[model samples]
Structure formats: C-alpha cells, structure tokens
Target: MIRSAYSHPVAEVEITELSAVPLNVVELLSKAHHPKAGAVVLFSGEVRNNNNGKEVAYLDYEAHQIMAAKMIRTILDDANKKWPLNIAIAQHRTGKVTVGETAVVVITASAHRSEAYQANQYIIDRIKHEALIWKCEYFTDGSHQWGGNCSCH
Candidate 1:
C-alpha cells in the first residue's frame, strides 16, 4: 500500500489510516460524480495473510510524504493527458495493517468508461511502482522482509 497524507486541488483526496480506513471509497467516487461523468472506476488493495511460501502476519508501509504525493499527482497528470478524466482520487495506507484490511483505494471519474478504466490502471500501476513507498512483510515465523524498496525484490 502507499502512504497517505496528500492535499491537491485537482483531486480532493483526504486519506486516513490511523484507525483503519475511515472513509468509504464509494463516497469518494460519489464526490467525483457529475451529470457529465458517465463512468467511474475504483480500485481497492487489501492485506493478505500469505505471500509465496511465507505466512504474512502484517505489513508496514512507509513513504516520503512530499515525494509520494508529487509522484501520484504527476501520474494523474499524465493519465489525464491520455484519458479524458473528469476527476481522480487515489489513496494508499501506511503504518501497520493486518489481514483483510483495505490498504489502498483509487477512484477515477471520466466522461467515458474507457477513460476511467485506463486511468484507473495507470494510476494504480504508477503509484505502486514509483510512489516511493516501501512495504515490509512481517512473517508469521517472526521474520520480516521488504518489497518495493528496490528494483530487485
């Protein structure tokens, strides 16, 4: 998941993960809703218990706030240039999160379904790959490993 704490004008993206995800993603989509916006796309990333052969106890996501927000905004800018988007909202959780919890959410509103679809994919992909977020897996065996810190996982 990506770290939250961003404020932008193009997108009203207030994110909180302090007591688990506090807002509804559907609500965020509704904010982007408009008569002209015919389509809205949403994505949710959840915590899992297992990765590969190891049992994951939980996950710790860390990020540089300024850099992450900048990267996300940049990705959104690029996506809007390619897709006719009306509004976009993306959020990812940080700190320790357990199983079955929501770790991230992305919502994209557009004039057409195609634009929403492509923009949704682009936003999530860019956020996961370039948002300066690092995830450490706390294993059931009391061991831990990190991912998304470097090119080599």
Candidate 2:
C-alpha cells in the first residue's frame, strides 16, 4: 500500500484536514521496515461520537503549524534517545474531524516489540503534552468546549 518511498527515518509532523488523514498505514509500516527491525507499532487516534456521555458532533483542531512540527520532532528525538528504534513517525490532523475519522497516527519500528511499543507511547504522550495544538469538541446539542490540557477525563 506504500505508494511512494521516503528518504528520512522519521516522518512526523503534518497539519491539515483537507483530504482526510491520507496517511497510509502500509506506507508507514514500510517506512519503518528494516532488515533488522523485528517489530512495528502503530497508533491511530480517531474521532468518536460521544465523550463522557455527551453526544459529540465533531472535533475542530487548530495548531501553530510550524511550532507543532518542531515540537513533534523534538518528541521523536527523545524517543530515539530512549529506544533502539529503526524508524518512527507521528502525524496529527488539523481542521474539522468527524466521527470515525482518524485524527492522529503514530508508528514506531524497533528491533523488538517492547521498544517499539514504548517509543510509540512516548511519542504520542509527548505530542499531546508538548505540541501547540488545540482541539475543540462540538456537541450535537449546539455547544462546544476547548480541550488540550492534561485533563484526566
């Protein structure tokens, strides 16, 4: 499914909602694939219809595009330092996202599953925490709320 090849080991950072999350899982996997890589982990964050019992209509995301990419790259660098990863990628979508649509994707490849899984988790957690991205949840009942803090909910 990889339509094209990538030259970099890390392919993270994107801000757009123009054509859906055009990220090809196969392509991401292939990008991380290596002769020595034994595991590849991928995470997809999708928009849901409900949040905490509220009927959700859609999610609107905004980001300081340049800052977001910079922060994401920094997170990836930290992950690389922590794990023996072959390749890793993280991408987020901006603009309006509807139910069942993917809002973000993260992939990690390593020599073992443990490293790949942990790195993937670290990358996502950092992106959510450090990136300058904001999300607004619009409810079906004609209301909306901004969320992006470290809210436990």
Candidate 3:
C-alpha cells in the first residue's frame, strides 16, 4: 500500500535500546518525504547464534561514541550523494545484546529498487567496515573474539 504524502520532515537519529524508530519507514519515505519514491528497502542486523560452527551465546558491542556517530553520519551523507536516496536512517546497538535481538536497522528509499538495494548494501558494508564500532563475540565455550574485522572465520 502506498503511504500518504508526508509534509513535515521527520527526525532521523537514534542510538539506544529504547530509541524510537520510524515505525512506518516505507510510508514515511514514500508518502511524506519523497512523493516520487517508488521503492523502499529495509534491513535489520540481528545477533546471530552460529559463527564458524560455534554457537554464539551473546554479543557485546563497544564503540568510540564520538567517532562512531561521526562515521555513521558520514556514511549516510555519502550514500545520499552517491545514490538517489530520499530518506535514510541507519542505527546500531551498543552495550550488550542477546542472540536474536535487533542490533542494527537500515532503511533506504529511492525512486527505483536498484538505488534502494544498492544504497542499503552500501550503508551496511560501510558502517561495518569503516565505523568506529567493535563487536565481541561470546561463544558457547565462554571465550570471545573480536568481530567487524573481515567477518570471516
């Protein structure tokens, strides 16, 4: 279903467990933010259980607040410049998150699905590779390893 046009711009930043998200991401972008929006792509990053056959018990993410925020904003800005994204929001979780919890959410709105998909992938990749964030993977054996570094076993 298409959303009604949104006239007033909405807030676009949050970084806590109780943070408010644009519940109507697709609608907000299509009807309110960009009247010409035809495609909307949303992605969420959740804590996973399997990593190299080892069951992950939990995850603790740490970040250099100042730098991480700056980097995330930079990623959004870069994506907007490179693509036809009308409204984009990308957020991550910090502190501790249990398995299956949503850790990150990225939404991209564009006139075409290509832009939406490309920008969505670009944002996720850039944040993981360039942002000042670190993830500690807690395994079933009570051992931990740093992630966000190649994502390879």
TM-score of each predicted structure versus truth:
0.80, 0.82, 0.77
Candidate 1 local lDDT, 106-153, one digit each (tens): 888877898899899988888888788788988999999889223434
Which window of 10 residues has the lowest lDDT sum in candidate 1? 1-10
Overall lDDT per candidate, in order of appearance: 0.71, 0.73, 0.69
Error of 1 at 106 (Å): 1.0
User: Per-residue lDDT tens digits of candidate 3, residues 15-110?
Assistant: 321222323334333432456667778887888887878899988888887788777877877787788666667777777878888777777777
Q: List the candidates ranked by TM-score, beginning with the highest.
A: 2, 1, 3
Q: Per-residue alpha-carbon lDDT of model 2 for 1-153, expressed as tens digits?
A: 111124434433332212234445565456656666788898988888988789999998888877777777677777877787777777788889888887788888878899999999988887777788888999999989889223633
Tell how far residue 84 is off in model 2, in angstroms. Answer: 0.5
Which stretches of candidate 2 lie above 4 Å from their native place?
1-22, 148-153
